[model samples]
Target: MSKSDQLINISVIMSVLIFVSAWIVGLATHKLPVLTTVLNLVVGLSIFIYWLQKQIRINQHIIEGREIVVLGCELIVIACAVYSIVFKQWNGWVKGFQYIFFGIHLSALVLFLIFMLTFKMNKLM
Candidate 1:
């Protein structure tokens, strides 16, 4: 397969793995909020590392400014989500913020998929 196809496959696999692992951890540690939060943080960091590795494979010359900005923002959101999970006391507002961050994180992933598909399609044409 082409590099783009390979990258896309890897991305999808990693995403699924992350989601499954998180769900499993949540189920296994249902009584231990701390353990669940830490495991989720590890999964989140793994995703960031995977993303960084993929970014490194791209040509630096073609990297766009907005892409970097969006990535930075996503990272911040992830960090906030982790922090809130670990530090904030469980309450209605904390739960709301967590959901908001989760939404941002998923939306960012969708945007990234769209960007990658468009880029690959443009290269083909």
Candidate 2:
């Protein structure tokens, strides 16, 4: 497969993983402590890993820049924030959800910094 295709595949898999983790965390929102902790840790780490891979595969490195993907990630985060604020009740496993959100935010910041630091784009035509 082409590099871009492979990256898309991995990105899909990671997204599914994140979704399943959120489902699990929601299920375990009020249950056994051991199970809750295990699921939370699993979800958190999966989020971190997924974002890490995306940053690498998309090559949004602060050194070897790619601005669009970074911008796109930020857009996703903005959407998520709006969804969470308008829809969510702000309790009951919100912390777990926020942990995942944090991952997304950090990922966006990495992307933003890349172009913000490296590239010198013109503002006016």
Candidate 3:
């Protein structure tokens, strides 16, 4: 990967780790509302914006149906996060969003690792 891509990847990983850690800590202690809510929203929004930019750059053409769906998902997550922050409570809607966010991200990470492993194995063969 180029330096910029590496940097982006590192940042994404760090932010995700921080996000997870914050959630765990908040759940355990019920303290650090700023870290749990505000930081999470900021990091989540930044990640979504990064992905949106990359998607646009790659496609170059207008966003198609799939991109629109992705955008909607991002917006849903953002909206849920905002609602949770404002309400200061985790309702079913917020919990559902949290589950979906982690599920999507974790599955994508697993698929990426699988693809990279297969590519490397093919190169060795």
Give residue 94's error in model 3 in angstroms.
2.4
lDDT of 1 at 123: 39
Q: List the residue pairs that clash in candidate 2.
A: none
Q: Rank the candidates by lDDT, best first.
A: 3, 1, 2
Q: Which model is ahead, 1 or 2, in terms of TM-score? A: 1
Question: Candidate order by TM-score, highest to lowest?
Answer: 3, 1, 2
In the range 10-34, model 1's lDDT, one tens digit per residue, is 7865765565465567558762343
- The candidate maximizing TM-score is 3
Q: Is candidate 1 or candidate 3 better by lDDT?
A: 3
Which runs of model 3 end up more than 4 angstroms from their true locations? 31-40, 47-61, 106-125
Summing lDDT over every window of 10 consecutive residues in candidate 3, give the lowest-scoring window: 116-125
Alpha carbon lDDT of each predicted model = 0.57, 0.50, 0.62
lDDT (10s digit) by residue, model 3, range 17-89: 6656766886688654545446546646876888767777784666679867876776776777788877876
